[model samples]
Target: MDQEDPGFSAVGEVAGDRVTVRVSGEVDMATADAMFRAATPGRVRAATLDLRAVTFFDSAAIHTLVRLADHYPGALKVFPSDRVRRVLDISGLGHQPWVSADQG
Candidate 1:
C-alpha cells in the first residue's frame, strides 16, 4: 500500500507476518496519523520503519512511531534519516534497540 500527500509519502510492503513501511518528506501532525495507519495494517507481527528519506520529523511523528513500537513491542525496527535521528536522539529514543542507522 502506498499513499502520498503533498510533502509526505508512505509506502508499505507486507511479507508474511512482517510489514515494512517507508516514509519520506515532512512528517508532522498533518501526516502522522496516515503514517501510523500505513505501518499498522491488519495483524502484522513485526514492523520495520524506514525513514531515511524523511527531511523533517516532528513530535507527532515521534508519537506515532512510539505508538507503533509499543504495539509491536520488540518486533519494531527503525531506520532513520539524519533529521529524524537528531530528533529521536533529543527525544531519548535514538539509542533504543529498535532504532538503528543500518537497515540490517
Candidate 2:
C-alpha cells in the first residue's frame, strides 16, 4: 500500500560524548543514507537513536544500525518503538545489546 513510500528523516544532536539522533517517519532504501548521515554526523563515543517516532522500520534501517554497531561497538544505542521492536524480533536483531527495547 502506501507503506512502500519514502518518508524518513533524522535529526542529530551532540551533548558531551553522546550523539543522539531522533528519527521520524519511515526508513527504507531511499532514506537510509540520510538517516545514517543524520544519526552519525560525526564521531562520538556514545550514540543513541531515538526511533520511537518512526512510523516504519525496514531492512535498510536494520542494516544501517547493524553496521553502525559493528563499527562503533558500545557507541550505539537505540530507543525503538514497539513497531520497530517487532521488526527487530522478526529480523532476529532484538537481542542486540545496542538496542534498548525497554524504553517503552
Best by lDDT: 1
Query: Mind giving the per-residue lDDT tens digits that candidate 1 earns over 1-104?
Result: 33445979888999999999999999988899988999998978999999999999989999998898889989999999989999999999999888986754
Query: How many residue pairs clash in each candidate at the backbone level?
Result: 0, 0
- Model 2, range 1-104, lDDT digits (tens) per residue? 23334456688999987888898888877777777887665657778899998888889888998877885787788999989999999999999988895783
The estimated TM-scores of all candidates read: 0.91, 0.87
Position 99, candidate 2: lDDT: 86
Off by over 4 Å in 2: 1-7
Q: Judged by TM-score, which candidate is best? A: 1
lDDT of 2 at 75: 78
